[model samples]
Target: MNCPLISLKAGAVIFTVLWTAWMMWWSGAYSTANLVILAVCGAAVGYVWYRAMRWQFERMGMLPHKDDRSAQ
Candidate 1:
């Protein structure tokens, strides 16, 4: 498991979510209620993005785990 790589990915996702939410709020010109919805959706997107990256990295043999050695 590469801790640095994982942290980098997480940081990127967080940055993306923050930037996206701000852009949505600034550009959508929506009401407070709608902005709340956007925030929720942005969170979901970030979670999915993070999971997808983790899955991809695992598949690519980039993510390591102590148990993985026993499996092989």
Candidate 2:
């Protein structure tokens, strides 16, 4: 079944957003510099994480190929 809520793209976005929000909250200080740093760092980390997860999922046949429109 193709479930949007459980897809890799959605997962990445949700993970990134939640991770960034958590880091901001955990830092306990909302300065502009801190926010910028946290956002940039969080996005980088999130991207790396997403790539890793995508690779693993593809290997395991859990995610479809980029050119596979039928999978989408």
Which candidate number maximizes TM-score?
Answer: 2
Best by lDDT: 2
Q: What's the C-alpha lDDT at position 49 in model 1? A: 76
TM-scores of all candidate predictions against the true structure: 0.65, 0.75
lDDT per model vs. reference:
0.72, 0.81
Those runs of model 1 whose alpha carbons end farther than 4 Å from true positions after fitting are: 1-9, 12-16, 22-27, 65-72
Location of the lowest summed lDDT over 10 successive residues in candidate 2: 1-10
Point out where model 2 deviates above 4 Å. 1-6, 64-72
Give candidate 2's whole-model lDDT: 0.81
